[model samples]
Structures are given as C-alpha cells and as structure tokens.
Target chain A: MYAFFIRTFEGSKTQVELLKEKIRQDGKVLSEEVLKVDSFLNHQIDPVLMQEIGKEFVARFSDQNITKIVTIESSGIAPATMAGLILGVPVVFARKRKSLTLTDHLYSAKVHSFTKNESNDISVSKDFISNEDTVLLIDDFLANGQAALGLIDIAEQAGAKIAGVGIVIEKAFQPGGELIRKAGIRLESLAELQSLQDGKVQFVGEEAF
Target chain B: MYAFFIRTFEGSKTQVELLKEKIRQDGKVLSEEVLKVDSFLNHQIDPVLMQEIGKEFVARFSDQNITKIVTIESSGIAPATMAGLILGVPVVFARKRKSLTLTDHLYSAKVHSFTKNESNDISVSKDFISNEDTVLLIDDFLANGQAALGLIDIAEQAGAKIAGVGIVIEKAFQPGGELIRKAGIRLESLAELQSLQDGKVQFVGEEAF
Candidate 1:
C-alpha cells in the first residue's frame, strides 16, 4: 500500500479531524453574496499556512519517487513551489495562455474552471517533462476533477508516470475526489469539506452536506 | 544613490557587455516561423525571467523600507514573489481575471500586454494592499511603460507609497525606461539591451541583456 494509504487507513484519523476543526476556525466565512472562502483559503490569506500545508503533503507522499511537481499557474504555483522546495524537485506550472517564453512544441489539454465559468487550454513546455518523469500533481483546491484530469492528460502525452495527486483541500461532496479515486490513482488531501450550509463551512464525517 | 542605481550605472556597463557575449554564444536564431526574442526583450521573455532575475533585484533594493512587494499579475508575479521572499515582505499579486475567490470590492486597473497583443483588467483585493503599505513594483520588462504605469496607478489607488520600480531587463532603446526616468521613479534593471542585430542580442553597456 502507498504511504498515504497507510496514513489514511491506519495512521492518525484524529489528526485529520483536528485539521478539519482548524480549518473551520481559521477559515472565515464571507458575505453570502461572496463565495465560501473569499479570504483565507482561496483569495487573500497567509503564506505561512500554505507552506505548512506543503510540508504535510511532502510527508504524506514521502515514499513516492516524484520527479516533477506539476501545478496550474497562479495560486497553485505558490503551494507547488513550496512542496517542490521540500522534495528538492523542480516545479513546472501549466500556463493558462501561451507566452513568448514557452516552447512552440507543447503538451496541451483543455481545462474548465468552474470559478470562472469558462474553458481554456492549459499547456506545459515539451522540454520541461520527460518520459521517465514521475509526476506529483499539486493544487490548492479540488472541487471538480476537470483541472486534475487535464493535468493527467498532459502528463500522459509527455509519457510521464503519475505517482499520485496531492491536494491541500478537497470538496469531498463534489465529484472531484470521487473521480480521482475511481481512476485508481492515489489521492491525498489535507482537509475535506462536506459542504457550505447557510454560509458556514462544514466538514465531512461530522455532519451535513 | 541606491546601490542598484550605482551598480547599474557603473557595474552594468561591464555586465551588459558580458551578457551580450553569452547571448551570442548560447542564443539560437529562430526561423520566421518561430517566435523571435527581440520582441521578447520588451514583451515575451521579460515576464518569464522575472523570478530568476529577482535574486539580483533584492540585493540592489535591499536597503529600501518596503512593507510589501506588489506587481500586476499574469506576468509580474514571478519576480515580485522572489523579491518578496528575499525582502521578507509579503508579495501580493494582482489578479488578471475575476474568479469566485475574489471579493466585489477591489483596486482595479487595466494593463495592456504588448506581446499578447491584448489588454487585461487587473485587480488586488482591498484586504491585500493598504494605505500603510510601501510597495516595490517588480516587473520583467519595461517597454512602452503602460503596464508599469497601470501598476503605479493601482498602488496610488490603494494610497500606498512607492518605494521604487525593479525591472529585470530594460530595453534602453525603447522609450519605456526613459519615460519612467522622466517621471522621476527609481528604475533599476540588471541588464539593459541596446539593440538586436540579425537576431543577435546586444547589450547597452558591456553586460548581458
């Protein structure tokens, strides 16, 4: 079994429970007009907290032979870079749009951003990922599986091995975590949210969704 | 005089010459079918190299009393983050697109990317940059000066004081640097390119551009 499987199956279930509680306490609920986490988790908050999340991810997947840590650009780059620093690996972020620095020959995949309510092509330079690479995909949030699937497609096109997916927070009520589990790939999440009820964030294994 | 300005004015002449020699040795020529890097000095390559170039930037601007390192994102975030880390200040990257994560109230500006051949609306959350902030603007390239001007505008909107502007590589042949200089802003660049000859990268002084 994978290292995360050991932790999730046999290790501290109470630790996970504590983290959920911490998230509820630390993460603020914005106005009902705003999304659930317009402050800490998603938008503007603490970098130190994010770095700790990165460390937890590194510990969870310490057994995997990860080559490159892949993440989408912007917010994901911060946590991914932190994880890369811990693992001593290079962090390659997928670009939402093509730029001059990017190579012409690239592995391209389409991703739908539920937050933006739009679709865009994400790409990685051909020179960045090699066939022998074992990739650890990292992201801040996983509400839907679309972005992760797009990253998987890019990794496959480059012939890189998918070691596993590491997420800081996963909306367990959503289809994202379920889809990755169904794919038979190991998925490790630091925190899981059951749902947002009446503008308050709730956790799974405790109560309502 | 700032150490960066002193070093740039004195040390950069030699560094620019050295960079030119390196580029001539390592730089590759592109077919018309491929993207040329001349526009890259102003447009494409500038933003990508921001992070790598930021190490030198921090050393130059080390004496400044900077509270936060700010940059208009989608491009400027790279160097801004690196500088933030070195300066021990929080780097706030302005968002290029509205997402579910953002609040309705924001300090917004419109920046035109010459390379992408389009204009984008950029914003920072009100909670990020405050009136008490002393910001150092970091950008990859300084070309026509619109992007930098837009960032300055955003900083002003937040009532933040401007410490200075840090640029990775400046295209001295263009009016961007000259304009910023005329505005009396402290603009420091690691490498300044005088011109491009037959796809060859040329430097302003003796250092690499």
Candidate 2:
C-alpha cells in the first residue's frame, strides 16, 4: 500500500540529470573507452540511487505491457529487481555460468564480453520466459551491446515479445545504442555518455535527447 | 518519506512463516539435498517478496550498527540491495571474476560452489570495505556455508567487524547454520527447512524459533 504523492515530472532536475551528476562526481575515467562507476553502480551499489533508477526505468517504459523484467546476472540484477518491485513483475536474470541445477529446457545465448575478451553462455530456464510474455530487458551498462543483444536473442528464442531495453549507462560513442535503435527496438539509456576521453566525463548533452 | 505504521509484530503470521508458506507452495525438491526455489528466489525473483525479506532482515538486525551490507554476485545482489535500501547503506557484492577494471588493491577469497563442483576467486575492491565498518553479510541460501564463510573471510581481510549474517533460507540439515552459530555471530535465517525428503518440504517450525 503506497501513499500516492501528486509529484509532477516537470519544473525539476530529472532522474537522468541526477544520475549524470552522480557519474560526473564519482565515476572514474579509466580511459576513452572505460568509465568505472565502482562507487555506486557495479562493485559497490548505492541502493537509494538504484531505486531512483528503477523508478525512472519504470516511468520510461510504463506504456509497454511488461509482464516480466529480464536482465543478465550480477550488475543488472539490482536495478532490474528494483524496477520489478515497483511494476509488480517477476525479474529473471540469466546466469553466465551453467549452474548445476539448471540442466535442461533452457533458452540460452552467447554473450561476448569485450572487456574480458571472452565469450560466456548466458542462460534462462525455459520455465521463466515464454512466448506469452512481453519482457523488459535491463542492464547496468550498454557498451557494444553484446549483453543486451544476447538477452534479446534469448527472449526471441523463447518467442517472447520484447517491450523495450532499459540501460543505466550507455556509451554513445560505442555501437550499442545505434545497433539497438537500428533494430527498431525501444532503448532507454538513463545516462548517455558522449565520451570518457581526456580523463574527463562528457555527456551527449541534454539537447541531444 | 514513509508513513509510520506502528503495527505490532504479534497476532499475525511471521515473515518467516510467510516465506516458508511460499516455499512449500512452489519449491521443487530435486532430492533431500536440493530444493529448487527458482520460481521466486533465484533464477526468477518475486520482487515484492524480496522487499519483504529485506524488511525482515533489517528488523532483525536493526540494532547491530551496520555500516555496510555485503553479499556475493548474481542471486545475492537482489535481496542484498533491497536490504541496503531500507538500512541506508551500501551493498558491496564480491565479484566472482577478476574483471578488467578490478585489477589491483583487492580483498580476495576462494569460494567453492558445491553445486558447480568448482571454486571461484571472489574479490572486492579495497576502496569498499574498511576497518571502521561493520558489515551484515546476506545470501539467498545457506547450504555448506562456503559462500558465507568466504564473505566473512573477505570482510575480515579488510578488517571490517562482522555485525551478523542473514540468510533467506537455511537448510537446517546442513552444517552452515551450525558452523555460523558456533563462531558466535548472530545468524538470522528467515526460513529454516527441517527436511525435503520424499519431495515434501518440512520446516523446522515456528515453535523451534
């Protein structure tokens, strides 16, 4: 039972702005290609921030009839679970490893991690995802879009309709955002980074959206 | 801001009972040793139930002066993040892999997954946990206690004081519960299973608690 607050989304700094501000303040610029947000996103998480991100995701994708929230293991689980909490949907995270319990009747795809330069098979039990479900895919970061694409592949394998893709951070300089958009899938990246070059953080700018 | 409800913890089914009821209704007993709860806990998560689990954990450990909530990757991240949100603390999940950005100045521990029949070197960045902190370690399931012990080892390696350990479910037949209790740390397992033999879930029961 939630008390409804008549809070409008106008005349205020958006959740996207707050997330970008947090990134600017705490995100580590490792190089032009890498930005480490270990302080709040991946390694160590700020739960309040995650909850805010979740709300933002739900607001952005509210139009879609999302029956389930699908995400990859580890980082994606936090924000996905949070959004699933608010939306009253189940969250399924695809495991990168072949766990002993998950033996058969699975929908799986190979996700190539560009950072680690290795391919890992990510899987979802067939019992979780099905053709009748319209799934909203979520992830912490979208770089080359390998993980997102892998999720899409898995969802398609189950003959499920994809509602959209929600990403916490999207590197605009990379091909991920373009690829997803070109594929005619709805993609919402909360903080779209233009560049992490010159040991500085640069956003794609608010007007670009 | 939350509306304060002074609801007493009496004259109602306990959080543990609710969790056990859900388990009994949905859990699949693969054998006497394994109870698959993928429908709600792991693989696929029930977000509302996870939030309840989080609140119960916070209520149980509210007096511990906890500064951080720590857990392993994947399954543990969801419930741990939920607890972190309620407690106003950071949830630091130890990475099961040596990620590219996570190279140096780390606290590492080897966790052997009996299910996978393999060992993974789980690591945490040195920047997260410290001696000044008191961490509450959380997990979805406690079987052999290998994962919990590994977390304790990592937290101890950083000189962080162990406030307590919280588990969503504990196989009372397993050594994990006893091992943690013998170490003199407060252990709160929401649902304790007495047995899963012959494909039936038997709880340790409310009177035992």
Candidate 3:
C-alpha cells in the first residue's frame, strides 16, 4: 500500500494552518457568515489530507485512553475513520437516517444541523457501545454544537465515558465551541475560524482549545 | 502511522474468504433475504478489517489505471478511503442528504435502497469528477443495481470512464451483481454470498465471477 501511494507532502506540516489555507484558497464564501469547504472537506475529499488530519487528532488526544471514536453520519465519517485507523479504535457513527432494515432496539438522539437548518433524529445500534468504553466524538465541522452534543448525548445514553470531542474545524465565534467548553468536556479542533468575514478566515490559534 | 497500529495479521490472508467468514459468523440474518452486517460494516466498524478489505480492492483493480475511487455516501466511504490510501487516488463519495451549503452545479442520480426500502437522490460535486478520470466504484454491499447504476450514471454524466465496481459483499441471488455484469462492467466482489439461510451463509465461490 505504501509503495503504491507515496509522494512528497513537505514531510512536516501544520494541520491547523494547512486547513486554513485550504479554506482561504479553495473555500467558497457563500455569504459573509458562511464558508463552504466542499473541495477538500466535504463534497470532494482529499483522503491523504484526511489521513494527516486523523494523525493530528491522535496526537492531540494522545493522553486520553480513547476506546471508541463516535461521530455522526456522512461528513464526519472520513476524518473520524482516519482517527480510528490511527488510534486503533472502532468508530461507531450515529446514523442520521435509519433504513427500514434497522433494528428497533437502538439509542437515538435529535440533532440540529445549523448548516441545513433542520433537526433530525440520529441513532446508534445498542450493541455497538459499552459502559466500559471511553468515547471521543469527532466531526468535520462544529457549529452551534448540535451534532457534537447529540453524539455526546447518545454516548451518555449508552453509559460510555465521554473522552473528548475532536473537530476538524470549529467556528469559534459560534456557540458550539463555547458550549462544549462550558460543559467541561475536552474538545480539540484542528482549525478554528474566528470569523468568516469578507471571505477571509481568521484563525482562533492557541485559544481554540 | 502504520507503526502505531501494526499488529501481525498473516500477510497471505485471502480477503474474500475472511469477509465471507465474518458474514457467516458475525452477520445477523434477520430473514431469508436480509443480512445485517452493521456491527462491522456500518454502525460500528472494525478498522483493521476495513484496511485489509481496502488493500484487496487495490489488489483486484491494480490494473485499468484507476485515477479515482468513487462510491455513494456513508458505508462506502471507509473502504473507498482505504483504497484511496493504498492506490494514491483521491476518494470521492456522493452525498445522500444535501447540506444547505451545497452548490447547485452538480451531477445527480436517484438510487433505490432495497434495505432502506426508499429511493434517494445522491449527488456529486461537478468539480470532483472529470472526463480524464478512470473511476473504481466501491461499496460495502451490492444488493440492487440502483446505487451502482446511479453512480455510474453520474460518472457518465461527468464523462469519466468506469474502471470497475468493487463490492465487499454481493448477493448473487439478487439482480445487482447480474445487472452490473450484463452491462459489460468489471465487477469484483470480495465475498459473493449465494444464499443466507437459517443463519448460515452460502458463498457464490470463484464461479461467481
């Protein structure tokens, strides 16, 4: 696998700054308040970059004995998976949409997506999480704290210990980061954008933790 | 990264057989036609096994000069990303539920999920796929041809060549596998189960291809 895909990626790179550069360059400023990172973050993914982001997550939360990584469906799957791969932990993603084949016995929570402007119920199989496990919630973006809180709520319902939340990008100006911080839950964001004004990204820097 | 999670897995392991064994032993058979592999395939993932599955995809589609790996959202992402890592190609997954941030410029297709008993319109950003790419479609399961055909239809819309379709499990009894093969597509399933009866899995064997 290594022999197949190997290239010079500047050997050492800063996860936070690289993501910010991607947002500034490839990101679309839909509005003064919104930034779309579809090119690298969501719609079109850079797997190699995601692997780098995943490694950064493991490095940030190296001390926590994270037994399992939890996240919401779709967007969170990629980065969360990369972390799962590096951390050697199973990733249990909460499903936003339940298929007809889904078991009735499950743990579920209502999550509101600020971006989508809609609230949806997300569920996880009861068999996946255990009381002895420590869960780290991860997602692509943290806005309004809806999805993260929802995942944390689900983990709590499963009686799993809350390790922390690993976010790829966090809108520091938004209440999500503040809310998670106030709750005394550990949160690590690779890139924290303080403001998305006039299409320029303001890094939250060391204060992002 | 590999050093952090490396454990001795027999290097000569057969990908197809291992997956079949997983389905037979751990897979939940809800009924005659339905098999739930959510424990490992979806809800909670065994990252190590997924890595092996990914390597096998790279092995099978080692030729055809695959430039990109594609799949519909959620379940397909993990294995596709793994393949992306080994093959050094970018992995792109179609989004099932569109976030409000998504741009209107896109190639979209409707897919019917037999398990979900619903039809969803999955879309890929127009910027991701190009006419030059040779895409290898990967998925956790290939039940009905709906998802694959939908993705292929989207790729054709983008004028991208279809390299092949790699499925972890293919229900040979269903029309999905047959449909892809009839369309003169290179279809590779790591484990093709002919029938799942009374909690037992019957393989399609090498004759499946």
Model 2 interface RMSD, one decimal: 3.1
Better candidate number, 1 or 2, judged by lDDT: 2
Report every candidate's CA lDDT.
0.66, 0.86, 0.81
TM-score, cand. 1 vs. native: 0.76
Residue A129, model 1: lDDT of 84
Tens digits of per-residue lDDT for model 1, A98-201: 33344468888888877678888888777678899999988777888888888888899999999999887787777899888888888998877776657777
- Candidates, ranked, lDDT: 2, 3, 1
Candidate number with greatest lDDT: 2
Cand. 1 Cα-lDDT:
0.66
lDDT of 3 by residue, B130-175 (tens): 9999999998888888889888888999999999899988887889
Clashing pairs in 3: none
**Residue-level lDDT tens digits of model 2 in A7-125:** 32334867787788889889989988999999999999998788788889989987888999999888899999988987879999998963334557988888888897888889999
Each candidate's iRMS in angstroms? 9.8, 3.1, 3.5
Runs of candidate 1 exceeding 4 Å displacement: A1-26, A30-45, A97-104, A205-209, B1-55, B97-104, B207-209
Q: Is the docking of candidate 1 incorrect, acceptable, medium or high quality?
A: incorrect
Chain A TM-scores, all candidates?
0.81, 0.91, 0.89
Compute the lDDT of residue B41 as modeled in candidate 2: 90
User: Which tens-of-lDDT digit does each residue in A4-41 have in candidate 3?
Assistant: 23242556667666676677788776765677888776
TM-score of each candidate? 0.76, 0.92, 0.91
